[model samples]
Target: MADTLQAGDAAPDFKLPRDGEGFLTLADFKGKKLVLYFYPKDDTSGCTAEAIAFNGLTGDFAAAGTAIVGASPDPVKKHDKFRQKYELSFPLLADESKQMLEAYGVWVEKSMYGRKYMGVERTTFLIGADGRVARTWRKVKVPGHAEEVLAAARQL
Candidate 1:
């Protein structure tokens, strides 16, 4: 596992494919605050709830000048279907190689039913306009999480 990034550290730059489209890079939102979240998979229970919560609050995030983006190891095809299913208004970056997930320290050793596997840890990072991490939530719980992120973004 890589060292987990802390608040105030420079956010890593990445170029990943958007859902059924071209690539998106960190620099693409350089002038705006970014809510970058990492999840295990598309259409899963926890992941779906988290994405839907953020989707419901898309306008509030926009009003706060923050752009929301989700990342997962799923392919662009899966992302496209997930977005369409949830009506998510934000881009879901396809990190098929787990590059961005590892960089963000969300990819981890997870145990379920006594089986060990590697997957995303349900994390979120609030990045400031200057590209520094302003806040990070590891092992995130879906309920009311987006609201908490919005509150944090307002402070930034």
Candidate 2:
């Protein structure tokens, strides 16, 4: 397990494959505020809603000079499908090895139906232009979460 990052700490750097074309590195986002979100899976109900809500607010995020990036343990193919299905404007990173998820402290043991399994926990990190965590939402509730992230991005 990786150490949990706290607000005001430097966001961890990662390089992961995007849904299309090529890979994206944290360095590429320098000089811009970033909304880095981690979700459990692709095309699931809550995940779908969260992605769509973010997609719906892409313009607002752009107006604030912020970029959004979603990450999951799913493969690049899955990300491609999810992006295409939702018309998401941002890149969905493929973290097949779960390294990035663990680094972000979003990968953990989760319980459902009396069974526990390791998975990505819903979380979001608002990274400032300076590359530090400006805000963080852990165990996030998907409903209205994108709007809350937008508000934080605006403040950044």
**C-alpha lDDT of candidate 2 relative to the true structure:** 0.92
Give the per-residue lDDT of model 1 (tens digit) for 50-95: 9999998989899999999999999999999999988889999999
| Model 2 lDDT per residue over 27-142, tens place | 99999999999999999999999999999999999999999999999899999998998888999999999889988889899899999999998999999999999999999999
Candidate 2 lowest-lDDT run of ten: 1-10
Each model's C-alpha lDDT?
0.93, 0.92
Clashing pairs in 2: none
Top lDDT model:
1
